[model samples]
Target: MSDTPIEFKDFIRIIGRGQRAGRTLTMLEAEQAMSMIINGQATAEQKGAFLMLLRVREETPEELTGFSQAFRAHTPTSITELSVDLDMGCYAGKRRHLPWFLLAVMLLAKNGKRVFLHGTHEPDSKRLYLKEVLPQIGFEVAQTPDQAKVALDTLGFAYMDLKHINPQLDGIIQLREQFGLRSCANTLARMLNPSNAAHSLQGIFHRKIDVKHRETAALLNDANVLCFRGEGGEVEFNPLRDVTLHLSRSAQQSSEEVKATCETFITKPQELDAKQLISIWNGELDDTYANYGVVGTLSLMLVLVDKLDWNVAYQQAQQMWQGRDKTWPVALPKYNLAAETFDTTGKHYAH
Candidate 1:
């Protein structure tokens, strides 16, 4: 209750008050608060304080749903016309290993699933991003919604950077560097599901965040939402670690703990090479550990996509991997022969 006009500070006060008296924002309040920030109505100080306060506390499902709703309201609705079957969010870059979940995405695409992948061009220098790896693996990143439509229509998969999808949200996401810590922007971005897809896959770095995402999915009445603790917080499951999946399907929330498929941990390579993505897909690299990561993630996605039993899904994923077209993009109908090798600099360089 400051003497000055209420404005955004009202939200700041609600969440920033002493822990004893502080309260979570209701869905409508959170939505309105986020709308103010997104519409540039909140001052820089108010924005920083609001984000940091939410970051320090575990954001409630209502707050997440509200924030995401505000963001989705501003994004383009054109992608919905394409009827993307799966919505995958990638924000956290990989540090421990290559993003094996990407292989799972490609596998789904190869099997005729329309997938829309969205992520920020994260500024983290220590990690590997999808934008960087996609090109190295012979896939180009989409710069706009129209380009994404083309990719999805032709390849059954597309990765659009968050900046293009919603620049205001991406700007807030980039504030992580300035704050020296991640804020709720990252979590809210993952929850956008701009395409209004029936299924969504999200990876969380913290278990508490997983709960928030699960509960939020239920509140949003999402058809199928899967949240898991992914490798380096990217949506790729680590088969070596037992994974607890938080799911919200048909507006009901539940959880499942899938046992690790193996006991041995793969040794981290000294230098990261993304080109191995293609080699492994081509059957030139027989990497047991990498294969496990891919199959493990694919099985989890099957649970999301088809509602299959975990064990049965694992078996089916193995079979799918084994039967995969080794020649890959060459066999793909829209994969251009000239753009066989995409460069990391966002340029298409011919072989």
Candidate 2:
């Protein structure tokens, strides 16, 4: 409870003793270890060693659960009070495709389901992050939890950057650049649903991570969670590939994995300009491939949320798309450096 920093040696020794000598941290140990790091008790060397050792040994579901618990403890209660039907984790930047899920989340918000989508992208990321793309549509990524609540109250949805969620968590996540590879931070961050939403959707780049996410969600007793290998590990459903759904569905507060398949609807990913997301949403452009991408993703999320049956969800997704609001914010003459300026200086905002 003191501001004086404690060196991270005690926590590091638990997981980095020696080859075959070091042991995995128990759930309690992991949580305590994470607390120390988040509290700035860990030295830089110990932080890197702890993360690297965990990566080498591979992270267990229990470790991930503890990591997430530590994160949720830090989430501001104001953001948690806002009603979020779904908590979407979008840390994985999309490389080959634009984030169609952005439009999907917006449409779901329009349909009266409050959503809290949050994440951060690497500075050296080759992909376009939602931070950059959301701005084009006049949406400001919330810089703080209170601002996130405002975005939801006024815009019907919220996109929060990782820095706002927990600066310490964000600090560790940024270390990916120095580590030369991702660590457990990416996995645990994706599983963090700070608002305690009943339903969550995770998009993993690898199939193996799908199992870890579902397992961790079940341990957390989440009412519903769906993790699948998505296009570039983002929540967008790829029409070009068969999606293996890794799910955790709860009944009577108990959760279990329910695996399913989403058969590929198209032969390949569509070749379209990424900027067309604007026209696609406004109904000015109608490409069959893109249309299927949007509707299919919506259906999957709907089914994941237990809002509709499989067949009914697909049908309703199409209808929802047809009646979407087409009113557009007047295109800004130039993009601005600050996103928070959206609410005050913009000509218009989502009604």
Candidate 3:
């Protein structure tokens, strides 16, 4: 690769060393390194090397913030201009359960909340993907920024795929199949918040990421961010697992959760089935755990908005779940990204 940031060694100097000798990229340094990758300045070898090196060391909050900033620079600035209540990111497809979270977002939409949900399905994943399910259920996904606004004006909600929103980040997210591990793009996608929505919620598979989401959003000065370790990493809850919500607002950070004075609900992960989402919403399935999952997930979002106390929010969530209309008529065809040996950037690997 032609060197821009440093003429000598460039990207490798950050990771091409023994553990003690290696260094993490500073905010600007990381942003510069990412610019090379996204701008097609880095060679394939450098891309792979850079991604794996950071994966081995793990990413820090500043590193995430820097990388995210570089990514945002490449994206259209107008996306953040749109106003929405919550920015919901759904990247990790659920492996062990139906997406109770999708229903919760839709319910909020049903009740006059503007929500923007975005995600991409992994090319090789067997998990129940929201990308496919949303379409399967007859929900139209916005392919462009303008279309997303239309959906919001009309339906009060919209689902967008990263493919259209920012193909650069989408390309990196698909790198998991090549590297067999996540890169900074995974974290980048969660922090996209394209609309710069005043409030945002993210779910992570790792406890550490739960904390990073709050810290980095605080750095970005996001008005409010609520993050927790989610079921299979999608912004849904496992009734059985205790949740610690890391919250960020006004540059101050704190951890919060519904006080749980009531009998806390619990459940084992259910078997995979997208159709189960419809049945559960219609109350035909009669699954105790699934019902509680939806209510608890909604309760968390209600608490995040702060219009009501935790107890009142919990009760409202319960009422919404009970009163949810059964005739939403959503259906899904299993969607697996059409197989591509190369990443979306069209960079071929020596397979």
Per-residue alpha-carbon lDDT of candidate 1 for residues 1-351, written as tens digits (9 for 90 to 100): 434545888898899897888899999889889999988899999999999988888688899899988988898877666688999889887765777788888898999889999897555435667887776666778987888888988888999888888899999988866887777888888888888898999998876778888999999898999999887788887877888899999789999989989787577665557767778999999887789989988998899999998999999999999999888583322333233332233221110
- lDDT of candidate 3 over 142-220, digit per residue (tens): 8888888988888788888888888989998898798777787877898888877888888888767788888888887
Off by over 4 Å in 1: 1-6, 330-351
Ranking by lDDT: 1, 3, 2
Top-scoring candidate (lDDT): 1
Mark the 10 consecutive residues where model 2 has the least summed lDDT: 342-351
How much is the lDDT of residue 107 in candidate 3? 82
Mind sharing the TM-score for model 1? 0.91
On the 0 to 100 scale, the lDDT of residue 54 in model 2 is 91
Q: How big is the positional error of residue 330 in model 2, measured in Å on the Cα after superposition?
A: 7.3
Give the winner by TM-score: 2 or 3: 3
Q: Could you tell me how far off, in angstroms, the CA of residue 141 lies in candidate 3 after the best superposition?
A: 2.1
Sorting all predicted structures by TM-score, with the top scorer first, yields: 1, 3, 2
Residue 350 of candidate 1: its Cα lDDT? 12
Q: Report the lDDT tens digits of candidate 2 across residue range 288-324.
A: 6667778878887888875566568878888988888
Relative to the unseen true structure, what is the C-alpha lDDT of residue 10 in candidate 2, on a scale of 0 to 100? 61
Compared with the true structure, all predictions reach lDDT values of 0.82, 0.74, 0.75
Error of 3 at 4 (Å): 8.5
Clashes of 1: 0
